[model samples]
Target: MNKSHKYKPLSFRTLFLILGLLFIFLLIADLLLGSVIVPLKQIYFSIFPSAETNETFRTIIVDFRFPKAFTAILTGMALSVSGLQMQTVFRNPLAGPYVLGISAGASLGVALFVLGFSSVISFGVVSITGAWSLATVAWIGSFLVMILVLYVSTHVNDVTTILILGMLFTSAVSAIVSILQYFSSESMLKAFVIWTMGSLGSVTNAQLTVMATAVFLGILLAFFKIKDLNAFLLGENYARSLGVKIVSSRVLIFASTSLLAGTVTAFCGPIGFIGIAVPHICRVIFRTSDHIILMPAVIITGSIVMLFSDIISQLPGMQTTLPINSVTAIIGIPVIVWMIVKNKKFDSV
Candidate 1:
């Protein structure tokens, strides 16, 4: 059988077009549907202001929903791409961006800042805002963990062994976080707990700019490794035979995953499932292992899935919002279950 014809086939262009449309529609819906239910006309005016537009409505749409929607899009794309890279590099169907404990490391960083140093900083009259402090600390923590993981990857020949080390790192980090939480003040603990719950609405326009830049850079790095990733899907020795620089590719892929996953964890909290499930969903939907097709497909599909999750999280007319993490898990778990039952390889998806 022809390689491309091994699995059920669909036109890549048609899938992209449909997913693109769905993404746009969901994005618009996300901006328009919220607790307040801003009218379509009001959303229109908010984007392109008109004299007749209600100022309050326009402000709500422009200042709040727009940024949240955009954050959802970026977070989805970053995580999905990160997961795709990890799976390809590790040759593990279950591998995800967070599988290497990047999120755990970020959480540890936040725990240190919020639980360990928060009281001292608060008492000393230091003016660091909690959001900025958490983001900075989280990024540092994730970077540190990434370095450790990369180092282990270089030393160990077994991918499974590296994965085991990643899990151990996560456990160690979580234990430290628990100890910090145990010793923390009530207020500080509450704040840290809330941050863990995850919120797309929390990102401001300025933070969004930082996140967008990080995600774009990480994605560019991934794009540079596309051919190598496809080669990797065939096995490392095979990839080496094809002249793929395995060590260099691993470093670049790890760096890309770190930047993408770390930034998202810093800004949005460790969103679950999108990273693990989106790539699998893309593979099954597109029926190809080619990174050329899978990369763009995962980006679009992840963005659409996340936009839909965000819209549901908002609860539309209700005043209460669900945690973004919870919503993503609910949406992603079923897909993961299906993947397990199907028990298919990447190339055969």
Candidate 2:
């Protein structure tokens, strides 16, 4: 048994129960607090389908809010798990889902499809073709980048060099995207720009289904590698001594990260800060480096934070809403800053 587990077994159980209840509360809150304030009773009927449910309320709840809320939960789980994996693999406090440039690679795919093909296709109307095509291209781009990074990792002995190389790939991809944006039509540029801002509302039910599937698989992969992840925290040599195949473990970890982060970016745009910040928040709150404790903690905490962000983004009882990306950055940046300043050693992990 881990020391953290032994010291506060009851506390951990209590915390998990509390967090679970909080998650339910926030999920209901997310459904209730949209542009139009929905009564809890009406919201319940809408989901359960009683005659008491107003048609308008049902449409709002079942069609719009429910998918968005689900997206929030899925996005949160995917990014947080991916972040935890990267931080462990690299043993770097600042490492995130995007550290390997998967986000940038996805962005490049979006840019090429939106901006590159803008000359031939007018995207004034967002269709299934337009939306699904964008996501498909983004996946391909991210997968290709993952393959490249994995290849580099196998050849490169130094993890630091791999990290730097990933950054360089991101920089290169960003430069290409910039060039595409510079020459693109105004309408196409606007479409791409809105994507970058991020919006949970934009995800359709079909897209939500795909996103949920990808995130579930990614998370399942992460759970399978929990032992390897714990081994990784003590460094490669220690992990190797324990018979963890460094290269294979690294590959699986990277694959998991790519799937989780890439799918979210493809569907939701690159929502910032959640990935890098949530794991650190969990580590501090749980007071343990053990993956067993941290994995579930990160999942529930990420969902709670994201559902809260979604509620805030809705700007309840208001006509307008803030961008989801902006809300996440606002909520996450402060947590990260405080963590850094409060712990100069960055030893929370």
Candidate 3:
């Protein structure tokens, strides 16, 4: 028996139970810890309204905090799951959703809307503030990149090659965005810059619905591929021997990752490092490579981490909130660095 297993006080079941509980606690904290510090009683009344409930407090909980908290949870889950898929598919511990430049593709789409077309289209489908304009354009850009990657996957058998090509495509898109930014008007540039900083609090309920739908679909696809993912951990040859459909599996994983990562990027402005760090954190905590356990673990852990980040961003007692992207990087980078220093062995995990 493994010594660590022998000495472990909590079984995996117990550990998961604890994590689930922690997730709930963190989620509540996320809702309650904003600048105004809505009381627990008020929050409860807001959720399950009563004659005694304060209408103003109810509005604070329902309108502002609830949406932001839910966005944080969804963003965390989507990014972490997408990262898990990327790491498994490429067999690289460092691989993440951002590695393939899906975020960059989404950024390009937003850049086009904010910088290139903001002044030109005053109305219609591509209008600057229409229902689906920004998010739809972002989806189009990410989907286009996904199509290109899928095409390349069909022709190229090497994962490294695919990664390199994805990077190249990202670089190309980024160059175009830079040019657009250079020519943009001051107002356009300011809008674009703010978008890049990312803000979880900005998503409306309707936008949250769309984001939730996309994330749910992508997560379902990932769940369906759990067996294939485990097989790939060993090698492509081993996976093929076990009857894995390599090409189809890769394409599906890619598509799923693109949807999950792209949707989060579109709404949250490419909140970084959670996707990459959360999986590693789960692997370390759960001590298992099995996606069966890792998947749920990552989901719960990701939500907790993101909620924590959001709470910190709110900076209790202060009116101004910090940019979510900055908080995530600040939290995630140290975890990653510590992981690297402690393990120094990516292949084993």
Candidate 4:
């Protein structure tokens, strides 16, 4: 008879159940604590109402808050997952979405469209002749940088060097974008700047669908590479010893990350801090380094954090909502700073 070993890893069932309940609590809290005081009864009635409850509450819940909340959750999940994947693939704790130039590439696409395509504007419907063109160019930019990094990875064994190279790629793109902005019209420049601030409120239902599709593809890639990701915690040599194909695994990680980061930036603009912060938050909350646990925890916590931030952005009395990026940065930057300060061996390969 063959002996079977049971993988009893601290009863993940219990841990996940706790986290799920916590997620629900946070979700309800998010719906409740925004600037506008949306009563619990109103929300309940909107979901299941008795004939003539109200339309205002329904509008607020369904029309305004629902979209914003959904956008925040998706953005949070996408960027947090992307950050975790980058950190694992590059074997650098500080690695993030912006490091790979995906954000810059998306920003570049936005810039080109704002400057070049805006000329074709009509009476009411703004022309979208270059929708694919913008997306294609952005994807190409991300892919080229990935290829360069992969090529360098083969030659240079140092993870720090690769990290620096990624930073350099982002910086180079930023320099080019600066030139583009300089030569562009004032209105175009303003548009680019506002877009950079980032906003979940801007995405339409159609745009949300596209963003959701991209997130789905990215998540699929991450799930497929879960085994490789688990093996990767040990360095490349160790992973190679376990029969993991390093090059292909890295490519998959990069492509998936690009898809997530690129799509979020394309639709919602370049959100900062979430990618870097969420993984750290996940680790702290979950208390486990296992990718199996950490991945889902990151996804859930990230969504919650973003939803909370969205609520903060809609401060009471000011019908004009605060910028979504501002709220995220306000809350995320301090956490990120503490992580950096506490981290001692940040230069590890």
| Tens-digit lDDT string for candidate 3 (27-67) | 88887887888788887898788898999888888889888
lDDT of each: 0.82, 0.83, 0.82, 0.74
Off by over 4 Å in 1: 1-9, 119-136, 343-349
Model 1, 1-349: lDDT tens digits are: 4654665555777789889899988988998898998878887777687797899888888889888988999999999999998888878766776777888888787677667777643432223354456556777887788788778766887777877877888889878877888888788887677778888897766677777888899899999999999998888899999999888888788778888888888778878789889999887788778999999998998899999999999999999999999999999998888787785553332
- Among these predictions, the greatest lDDT belongs to 2
lDDT tens digits by residue: candidate 2, 1-349: 5774666655678888999999999999999898898888987798688768799988888888988999999989988998898888778777776767778888788778777777533431245555567567777777788788778766786667866877898889878977888898787788778888888888876677677877888899999999999999998899999999988888888778888888889778888789889999887777778899999999999999999999999999998989999999999989988988997646535
* Model 2, C-alpha of 185: deviation from truth (Å): 2.6
Worst ten in a row by lDDT for model 4: 120-129
lDDT of 4: 0.74
TM accuracy, model 3: 0.90
Better candidate number, 1 or 2, judged by lDDT: 2
lDDT of 4 by residue, 1-349 (tens): 1221244433556766876787677666666556577777887888887776678878877777777778888898989998898777777777788766667766776666665566621210122333334445556666666778789878998777877887787787778778878888787777667767888886666566666777888888988888898788887899999999988888998888888888777667778778878888777555556788778877887887887788778775456778888888899989878766785433431
- TM-score of model number 4: 0.86
Indicate the residue-level lDDT of 291 in model 3: 98
Model 2 regions lying over 4 Å from their true place: 1-10, 119-133, 151-168, 345-348
TM-score of each: 0.90, 0.90, 0.90, 0.86
